[model samples]
Target: MPEPVTLRPRGGMIIAAIALVIAAAALVFIAIDGGLLDLARWAWPVVLLGWGAWLLYLRPYVRVSEGFVEISNLVRTYRVPWGDIDSVDSRFALTIRTRGGRVIRAWAAPAPGARQALSTQRADVTHTPGDDDTRRPSDAEGTASGDAAGLVRRELERHRREGTAAVGQTALTWHPLLIAGTTALAAAAVVSLVLPHG
Candidate 1:
């Protein structure tokens, strides 16, 4: 069995979240030093925003194992077996189309921005997996979605080449902790804004 490949945490996202957290901590310190809990209340959104940054950017990933592709999106995750996948696409993001016609997008791998797309020339896309005659910017070499889709496509092709008749169903699941935390933090932020903090 080939080793599984995972596109895990994005360093840029992690650094940005850390910066937000630091800013929130500074606000909290000011509130403590001044004995002003009201000021602390104003920091709720900042703290939540820090957590939100991590939730949206750092939490998502795409993992390609010998038998399956796991897509950990923002609030939901999907484990689609090789047998279930019809194709891997990178139109707007890295997406998996199942034999049953369900399409799953991976939030971790998104298309390049307009500037990046404009910079990608025909010379750069020579080795990309899809049709060269008609390729989206998402299929460009340096883009996140393009790279991830390449890995997924290669793995799928290898499965076909090896005659590995893998069998399984596609499973969908929600990120319970993410959902709960976001709800709790959003509520806290709202309360901090409306409730009288003395």
Candidate 2:
């Protein structure tokens, strides 16, 4: 069996983490300089920064294994078996439609530019078979989402032909720990805002 493919927004996540670190450092400096006494004034912006950090760094990812595709967003993770997948589309989002009429979007892999997608599709159709020597890199052919979607399509097709079984029965589940952690962080942020500053 081939190794699973883990797909996430590489550049955006890195940038968001860097921004969060800078924001946090600045916050610390302000606190040491006695600017925290006026924390209420800038608290909301800090909250916004935290939210952005979570959205960018924590929100979405897709793991495609031989038998299943796991799509995780903020609170929920959907594990769809290859056999259950009706189709995969990359219109507004990287959407997977199940045979039972369930449509789940992968938050991690957002759609690429439409023009780029179209051009890549054209290239694939026009390119001759057994032309690996002439083929361009995956980056040149499509966006990250497009590349991910293609990978998923290939795996699903392979599994469909071989009649692969589901790895586990459960699907469309949430990570309780992640939910609790994020909730706690949000509550703390809110509490700090309402509480009096010393």
lDDT of 2 by residue, 1-198 (tens): 578878887666887788788778767766777565655444555756766676665577889987788898878999988777887776556778888888897778776555655556445523322234433323232455656666777677777677784544438787798777767766767777787665
Task: State the local distance difference test value for candidate 2.
Answer: 0.68
Mark the regions of model 2 whose C-alpha exceeds 4 Å error after superposition.
35-48, 113-140, 165-170, 195-198
Off by over 4 Å in 1: 8-15, 18-21, 35-40
Clashes of each: 0, 0
How much is 1 displaced in model 1, in angstroms? Answer: 6.0
**Clashing residue pairs, candidate 1?**
none
lDDT of 1 by residue, 54-171 (tens): 7777878898888899999879999999989998888788989999999998888988879888888887777887777767777877678888998888778888888783788899
Q: Give TM per candidate.
A: 0.87, 0.72
